[model samples]
Target: MGDCTAQCLHRRAPTEGGAIVEDFTIIHDEGILEVLWRPGIGIGPGELDVLANTITHFPRWHASPVLVHLNLVRHITPPARKMLVAYHHAGPIGLTGSDPVDRVLAAFIAQSRSRTRYFTESAEARAWLSLIGVTAGRPVPAPAR
Candidate 1:
């Protein structure tokens, strides 16, 4: 991996009695933003809103490919799913998940975008993102072996 820095946006969960929690971690490496979500957490419109805001304010975000890890998500509300499908990123997006439900969800989101793909492995997803970045003139570095 290229020189990278990671940031965690500890946004409050809507159902956690107003406790501040880390809903997701965003890693910036080369020209990629890798988002790792909390396992077994339920995602709703509130969570998606926070995510959208965080990404929108991130530095150079418009030029970075995104890799979202969706494995082990307990559930995603219907409204959240709709928001995700409509969320726009200037660069390509790569979604990685293992469960069957994850695959189905990824397929649904990918179908709505020309620059999205689903992968069972994160490494594969990262590779795809790097390729897309290169083709798009972002030039993300390949992961080190």
Candidate 2:
């Protein structure tokens, strides 16, 4: 809603550890926030805080769809899992990528109030998000290595 569009004009400056952590990149367009995470970095309190902050950044975020690209991530720290249990309040979340750890993590977090779906392709994720009224912006590009 701010400066972001299909091209993702709104960019957060790289910070140490936040929602857009060193191991991940975040893109926003319309109301959807696409999180592209690198494998092996363990998510923890700092990362969780960053996610909360990002989601609350714009008023639309709470109601928006979040597409998490966890194709690369291999691990989720215990603390991070706990934090997810306590803080993952978003709904209509779409998760993609073939990482087994990511699948497990998504299932664990979606146990109660979270509405989550998994996909092997990003296009399907976006389609689902669009169906849910979350703006389906351009296809999310892969984060630069």
Candidate 3:
């Protein structure tokens, strides 16, 4: 009998972000960084400058010692690494992960153990921050005299 075989094909879903504006900010006293992973579902080279440029849109971005609320990061490439570094305000950056990262990334994540806190879920991430007196999505109070 002649050789017979069946072949299978698969498709991958499209990424989410686009040319739209991505939302993320570092509120000094508020202690919460709201990040909107828009403009392109995944991270890339220009994305960093785009995000960092958002600093011009809002003054809060320039704040130091910030904790960012990174949510819905499905995939990350080398370019993503460079872009993320722009968020140099703090290490142990708060991020949400559903996809698996590479060995190097995993190692870096491990480093966060001492400097940052992590959560699979966003709600928990926020709670973890609050537990440490860090707040998110809330307004900061005026400095005391």
Q: Lowest-lDDT window of 10 residues in candidate 2?
A: 2-11
What Cα-based lDDT does every candidate model obtain? 0.76, 0.67, 0.43
Best-first order by lDDT: 1, 2, 3
When 1 and 3 are scored with lDDT, the better candidate is: 1
lDDT of 1 by residue, 25-124 (tens): 6777666888878878888988777787887666778868999888867788888878777866667899989889998878767755448988888889
Residue lDDT tens for model 3, 44-126:
55555655655444444443223333444444567666445443453234555443443334344444323455456767756
Listed in order, each prediction's TM-score against the native is 0.79, 0.69, 0.48
| Candidate 1: segments with Cα more than 4 A from true spot | 1-8, 12-19, 137-145
Better of 2 and 3 by lDDT: 2
Worst 10 residues of 3 by lDDT: 1-10
Residue-pair clashes per candidate: 0, 3, 6
Model 3 superposed RMSD (Cα): 14.2
